[model samples]
Each structure stands twice: as C-alpha cells, then as structure tokens.
Target: MASDRGHGITHCDDPRAAQLSGLLTRRRQTLGLTVEQAARATGLAEHRYTALERGAGHGIDLGGLKRVAGGLGLTGQPRETFLLLAADPDVTPYDLVERRRPSIEELAHIDLMEPNPALITDHAWNVLAANASVARLFGDPGRAADGDRNLVLWLLTDGAGRRFADVDEVRADAVARVRAALAQIPADATLQALAGRIAADPLGAGLWRSRSPRLPAEASARRLRHPLYGEASVLVTTSRLPGGLQLIVHHAAHLIQSPAPR
Candidate 1:
C-alpha cells in the first residue's frame, strides 16, 4: 500500500520555497513600500501579500502575481513563476490553471518506416518522438532518450556527423529543420535557450541566420556513410507538419536501391 498524500505538490522543498519567498520580499522592499502600502497598490489585502512573501501554504494566482509584479515595476518573463504557482494545487484558484503539465506523448506522435531512417521533432527541436527506422538508421533506436538529446547537437558535434557523405547537405538540413521549428516556437523559452547555446558555436552560429528556403523534397540520392551500413547513397524525404506542435519527419528516399561507397 502506498500513500498519495504528497502526490502533486511541487517546489515544496524548503530551500526553493524560501528562495522564492525571499525574492518576493526583496522585490517588494525594493519598491520602498510597506506591506500595507504594497497590498493597497496591488489590490491585495496586506495579510495575503505577507503570506506570499513568507511562502506560506496559501495558494497564489497568476493574475494576482502579475498585479504584484506590475505594482513593483518588475519586468521580464513572469510566465515561469506563474506556471510554478499554477502547479501547486493548494495555491491555485483556477482549476484549469492547475492542470498537470503536458507530456511529450501528448505533444507529438511518430510513425516508423522500414529500411529508412525517419523521426519527427517537436517545435523545440527536441526529439519528442521517433520511429524504429530512425533508430536503425542512426544505429541506436534509443538514442533520442526522451527530449534531452538535441538532434542538432548530434548532427553538429557527435560521431553522427561522420555518417554524412556530404556534411554541407546535412548542415543545410539541420538549419532548415531548426528554422522551421523556430517559426512555430518564436517565443518559447526552451527553444530560445537552445538557439542561444547553438549560436555561441561558430559552426552553428553561421547557420542560425541562414535565410535559405527549405530544401526541395524531390527524391535525390546522397551518399551516407553509416557506421554499420558502410557507404550508401540514401534518398531523403522531408515533410513538415503545420500548426500547434510543429513537426518534421525525415525518411530515406531510396529504401530499395543499393548504395555504393562514396
């Protein structure tokens, strides 16, 4: 038998709570207003503001926090804090606000094709979901490992780069895919962070600003030197899915032809 008493509570760890509380108090104090004055300005009662500053178990609302932020003249992304507060059931007033965060399974789907390497990436370019062919082609079906392994990273720095007979083409494909994903997630923090990190790398930075239209999907055979498959010319097909969860699926264009070593 197991207890579900603490099932959904997050950020309950004392240090985090204390840290957030301290931030709240400092922000308020920085405004040079007493608790009562701050509460009056923010349309909250003094006690409520005090409890939030103390990080007491009282639930906080996103709108209320936005008001507080407005009153204190704080700027930058407040959505992160809003989401954190929304995750705490005890601190949230809106039921919809407290719904569980979305999972990758819920965000994107995949389909495998035999004898071809294929996979789909979410708007953040995180390999949210991949298919069997992708694993077989990459020689590791489990390489994606959820959303942690960035495909761009593998193409840029890992041994995966050795498989491309035409490194330029692969780099072009990577940039095209990244640009497509960026179009779908222009303001996503996770994607922005990734773009920033990639931009720091000279090779990656060069492609970051490429304005080239997407490469045509007309079946074209390109040499690929797979660690396991030796050298082969693999035809590639790339398809983009529009809206919500932006996805791009890539598959071998010539699954039946035998490729010669480059």
Candidate 2:
C-alpha cells in the first residue's frame, strides 16, 4: 500500500548521520569485525546494524546506542562521545574552537590567578594563553615552534625530560584524553594529523593502544624539578570554561626541601 519505502523506513540525509555512519563503519573495520560479527556484538539484527552503518537508522534509541558503544568496547569519554553523536548527529566541537580566543574578562581572571601557574586551552588542548607564572613553570608556550604548543604533546614528549615526577601516569592520562577528543571530533583534520604524530612515537603508540581510566578534574599533587626553582610540589586542578575551553591551574606550589646530603 505505502510506497515511500515499504516498511516505513525513511532515509536520513543529515550530514551528522553520515558522519556517525562513517565512524561506525570505520570502528568496526578497525576491530577486524565483519558486519555479522558487529551485529552480534551490538545485539542488533544484521539488517538493522547495516542500516545504521548506512546512516539510515537515525531513529535508534538511546538504549540501542549504548549497546552499540558497549559492543564496540568503547570506554570513558569515547563512550560518552559515541552516545552524544548518536543523540544529535549535527553536534560539532568547532563552535567552541571558533570562540577559542580568550576574552578580556578571561585574561583579567588569569591575571588575578597571579603567582599560581595558570593557562587556557581549547578543546584540542592547544595552549591559547598562559599567565606569567605558567611561563615561569613550564617554558613559555608562545615561544614553541608552530603546532608545538599543545598540552598533550608536551606531556607525551617533553614531560619526562622536564622532570615531571609522574610523567608516565600523566602521559597516559593525556593520551586517553586525546583519544576521547579525537572520537568526539572525528572530522577534524588537524586533530587527525596530531593523533598520527602521537602514534608515531613508540611510547605514545603504546599508551594510545592501551586501556586507561579517564582522570577526573580533581586537584592532584604534582612534583616538578624546576630548573630555576628546584624541586617543587604543586596542586594541579582543571576546570571547564566557556566555549569548550579549559582552565588549568597549578596552585599552592612551593619548593620542596631536600634532605641534607650525607
């Protein structure tokens, strides 16, 4: 009787739908799973799974999306990103990136944090602005070579040499964050290239492939061997800012007393 598409299945033409479809297909292929295998893993019928991969299953519910994410072995922020895209295929992290430049008010706030190392970063963790304290603690990002001002990049590459006492732990966490961010904005060419560079490094590649828990934004104590200030202890905290930016602060930092040499 009805001729639109037989069983009332409507084709979704949304660009986001296409993006989601591509992600699903790529992820399945990356895992070396066949369509049937993916369907089984997702607990969905073969045809339904295929439809989703074709961007034709826009009507899938949240429960269905959750099953898909779980079936794909996605965890932490990556899982959250998958569900978010499923809910609204049109979401883009670019809006936040577009507004990345810190406002005068934000700059003033950073200034107020004086004496405590503070910096602002965009969604991709590019160092947008930093206070004088941050420059003093970590070398000035402004002077970094083009495309080298990213927080994660610095952590993965320069952190250990810079005397970060918890370099391994910090590097792993940074890699996890990058992985999640990549999933959220799969279409970003810049981020894709950055990920490639990170994967090119042996340690970074190992950490990227390994599973790690997502760290919360709770304050954590960190030890740094400051070239000038000597060994120091600081409490690091991160907070979300407007426009998909992050405010990271190193608070209450003081030089650590070294035991008298024998």
Candidate 3:
C-alpha cells in the first residue's frame, strides 16, 4: 500500500527523510553505481531518483521501495529499516486518538471472556486495555512507571526486573516493533515523546541503535514462569480490529495451535 502524496519533490524537514536520502546515496556509491545506473536499475526516472536521493521520497510505493531495496542489495535489518523509513507518513490507520475505535463493550468482552492472557494496543503500542490473565502475568500495565502506558515502554522499562524466560530477547522484539511503528507516523508528537523516553533507558537505547527487525511472529513463543501460572508456555498472536486496533493474545502452549505466521 502507498499514498499519493505527490512525487515527494517538495521540501520537508523530516530528519528521517534526510537520513534515508543519505543512506541511499551512500549505499549506491558503496556499490559503485552512479545515479543514472541506480535509477535505471530500479526503474525510476533519473530526475525522480535524484529527487529521492535528495530527501524527498515520501510518495514511493511499496513495490517501488521493495524494488529499490532489492536493486541496492539491501537485506535483513538494513533493508527492513530503510523501507520503513521510506514509507509515507500517513496516520489514519495509526492515529488512534482521531479514529472512532471499537466500543469498550467489545474490547472488554475480549478481556473478560478470553481464558488466556490478552491485551489490546493502539497503533503506538499503548496499552488500551488488558485482560486479567495478562495483568496477572505482567502486573497491571496501568501501574507502569513514569506514567508510560506504552506496551514496549512498559515491558522494557516499567516492567523491568519481572522475569520473562528471555527478557533481553523480549525487550529486543518490543524495541524493533515500536521503532517500526514510529516510522509510519514520524511526525506524531505524542509517540515521539514516548520514544524519547524509551531511548533514555539503557536497554532500549542499545536495541534502538541496532535498528533490527522484530522476531518472526511464527517463531515467537514466550514461556513465563509466573507464580500464578507456573511453567506456562505462551505463544503470542495478534489480530487487527476495526480502526486499526491490535489484539495481542498469549495462549497457553497446549491451547495454541501455532504462533502467527511470520
């Protein structure tokens, strides 16, 4: 999916735009390709490609971004990170505050009815609602420190010291997911503020600088040894709800058919 935000020739002061342009230029140069050569390789017009390298590429389609990334031999974290950076800044699906989300009755029904641990998060990874099972596992997200109700922030910082079988691994996944989410709404001030706080945390900062992709969903199985549910193996699955809400469900190992596909 892409936005018709023009050819992205107009000037914009977004730091991410500059970073992407610089990265594209450097990567192309590293591969010993001139602007014309790289442009031709990616099927982009020469001037359009130049404009893209000059910090104005917010309108690039997903296919264009993928083609560009492939032509440049970008892969793994670097490729994933760059494509996210190149995506247009549209907040509709992500602007939780402005959208009319599902009713509380529906959200609470999942919380109250689900037998396993589950919670709902907004586009910014904020904990919109949590179930008793999830609360029992991670403590009340409402009691999170610094009033940071964000799921990633809560898991890495406020929910610190709580034992997850693989705390660092879990934190890394949280960092990557939050970082990717931020790229789609780089201009959101509220998300930016929370991201700033996340960066201040030593663990979060370390992972943020890496700019890695999140764990593959199909391989994401978390085992927690809580006093309430001792030796419980949980597999995380996410489903999209109306207005871009995300439901995160953690099912007991036996009850889960599988982790979500990557």
Candidate 4:
C-alpha cells in the first residue's frame, strides 16, 4: 500500500538514494544540528528525516524535499536537484511512479474535444495514449510500429513521412531530439533498442550521427499535408509532466494568405 505521502512516491533507485542521503547528512553536519533538530526544523518526523538522510527518500515527495531543502539552507540548483530527483530518479524501472491514470484520461478527453490533435508519450517515447482526431487525420497509431509503439519510429519509417513539405528537415530534427533524450537514460532497454533501430536503418543512421542536436522547440510552426486537408499549417507544442511523460499537441494555425506581389 502507498503511504500517506500522497503521490505514491517510492524509494530511490539505490544510487540516487545513496547520493541524496550523503548530501543531506553532510549538509546537516555542516549546519551542526542533530537529526531530531533537523527534522523539527523541516517539519518532518525525526524517523522520516532519518530515512531521508540515510538515502531512502523514495517515499518522499517534492514538498517534503522542499521542506528538507529549506531546513538545510539549500537554495538554487542544489535545491531544484533535490526536488527533481525525488520526483523522478535517474533510472526509471520501466514504470516508476504510479501515474494518476484518471487524470490522463481526463486530459485525453479534453484534448480530443479540441479541434487540434494531441498525443501523449511515456518516458521511452512510446505513444501510449492519443486523441481521436489524430487517428482520423493521420494514419492510425496501431499501424505505426512493427511491435512496440513509438511515434518517432513511425514518423521516420512510415510512408506518411513523405507528407511533410520539408521532410528531411523534419526528420533530422526528430532524430536529433531523440538522440539527445536517449543520452539521459543509457541503461533503458527500450531506448537502446530504439537507438539501435535508428542507427541500423539506412534512412536515419547518417542523419542521427551527423546532425548537431538542437533542443526541442517548445512550440513551432510546421507544415504538413493530407489528402483531405490538402495542406495545413500546424503549431506544434510540447509540454512536460512529472515522471518523464510528454504531451504533444498540434493546433492548426490560422494562415492568412498574403496578397501576391504584382
């Protein structure tokens, strides 16, 4: 059973636990405080604080870490690191935190109601959930993957890849972003497989290796075509959620046709 910590936060995945515990212990010692004193200052039970200082903050949430950080006089990036590490450790075990599935369902429902198309990917870039409008316009996510479902894989390998006006540019951008993301989780088997598949493919291997990676744009105007829509201008936006999830939304941008010069 999940403890009353609220987010079903689990224990740190070993290495992260040790690192965090050591940092907290050192910080407390520098401040010259007993565990009980530190716990009281942080608004945590002494045992809970002890568990955290001992590299076992797995069940701890961001707020708890914030309290600890405040008690430790930790500010700036060090404080942020504590919050981030608590929410998502360095190595996720396929599924780390128990996602509030109902909230995701709600998000999908709301997204589907919009005129735009939206899809959600898990940490490994697998297209786990999507809205109805996307399937209606683009090809179905069902036929996208050979076995596992990844949107980037589908885009790189599928015939629909040709639908972009600047297909090569689109492809290069996608490959670069995927490469950069995979760098963060080297031990992830799914990511390794994806990287291997990309590297082996004649189409994307060169692009993956040669292109300079760019940070993924938060939002960008893109052009795509469909037999029915003819061609549409889309504003693509990506938002990040806790637990390494990403929500990608495609909103149709209103393109005002300018008068042709005489």
Q: Which residue pairs of candidate 2 clash?
A: none
Give the whole-model CA lDDT for all candidates, comma-separated.
Answer: 0.56, 0.73, 0.68, 0.67
Alpha carbon lDDT of residue 218, candidate 2? 50
Better of 1 and 2 by lDDT: 2
Clashes of 1: 3
The candidate maximizing lDDT is: 2
Backbone collision tally, model 2: 0
lDDT of 1 by residue, 2-98 (tens): 2122111224467555655656666666677777787788777777766665565346565666666667666543434533542354432222222
Residue 138's C-alpha lDDT in candidate 2?
Answer: 75
Candidate 1 structure lDDT: 0.56
Rank the candidate models, highest TM-score first. 4, 2, 3, 1
**CA-RMSD of model 1:** 14.8
lDDT of 4 by residue, 1-262 (tens): 1343211223456677656765676677778887788888898897787767666677776556667788789876576656655555553433333232326564656366455677777665677677766686566776655455776766676654656666677788778888777765566677778888888888879888798766787887777765455566777788876556788877752321323234
- The TM-score obtained by model 3 is 0.55
- Number of clashing pairs per prediction, in order: 3, 0, 0, 2
TM-score of 1: 0.46
CA RMSD per model (angstroms)? 14.8, 13.6, 14.1, 10.0
